[model samples]
Target: MNTLNQGSQKYDVAYLKQTIIPGKTTKGQITQMFGAPTNEELNSTSTSNESNWTYEKTDEGLDKYMKLAHKYVSTETSLKMYETSAQLAKAQTVANDVSSVTGTKTGQSQTQGSVLTIYFVDDVVKYYRVY
Candidate 1:
């Protein structure tokens, strides 16, 4: 498939909302919840002096290309590949299952990534935004 860039690991919006709460969540909690952020800024905005912790993952919708790739790969699972026959076959089967719609539908834009920016003042979460 044609991928622009793999970018960072995926983030779940629901998980973030459920775990993090502004005014109550602490920096340690945020860090523990999502691990080290993708980036950090001393002063993210001119108007605010609060430290901004950013966790981001970007994807430009791979549904179409992924579908095409799935269609192509499904037809090749039986064929012998570079990897060991057992390993290759198993890998191919799993890949096909994800796009086969029996498991995960990778050809959906809803599998998009997220960018979470949490503004901190005195180690407590002042505000947060997830895009």
Candidate 2:
């Protein structure tokens, strides 16, 4: 009998929700933890003086032509630092309380877990964890 173990590795909720953080952490530290980032950007000159990084991961699984049975998971994490140290602590707090969920399917039925982490510094979402 064929088992799911032998199936190809595909992107799924399990792989997307792995980037969540719960404490004081910086973009540099997160990069070290998850390797190179997928994208990076800085806030507008009018906005805070800080940079953001986005890390993305994707995988393909099973073939369901009925409605496209490929799994794709992407996560974008952003971290920013201000001119004052006071903002640093708040930024870290906002980056630690993020959660999200995303998925797609067609004819057949697939039960996929939807879990996302939204990092917040000072109680605001800064980074996002999506699988």
Question: How many residue pairs clash in all the candidates, one count each?
Answer: 0, 19
Give TM-scores for every candidate, taking all chains together and pairing residue i with residue i. 0.46, 0.32
Mark the regions of model 1 whose C-alpha exceeds 4 Å error after superposition: 1-10, 44-49, 58-113
Candidate 2, residues 1-30, lDDT tens digits: the string is: 224222221124443344444445555555
Question: What tens-digit string does per-residue lDDT give for candidate 1 at 1-131?
Answer: 32543322325555555677788999898776666776887865555457888875532234334445555674565243323446966987777777677656553334334677888987789887766
Q: Per-prediction RMSD in angstroms? A: 11.5, 19.0
Instruction: Determine the C-alpha RMSD for candidate 2 after optimal superposition of all C-alphas.
Output: 19.0
Instruction: Return the lDDT, model 2, position 21.
Output: 43
Model 2 TM-score, 2 decimals: 0.32
Error of 2 at 15 (Å): 8.3
Which lDDT values do the candidates have, in the order given?
A: 0.62, 0.38
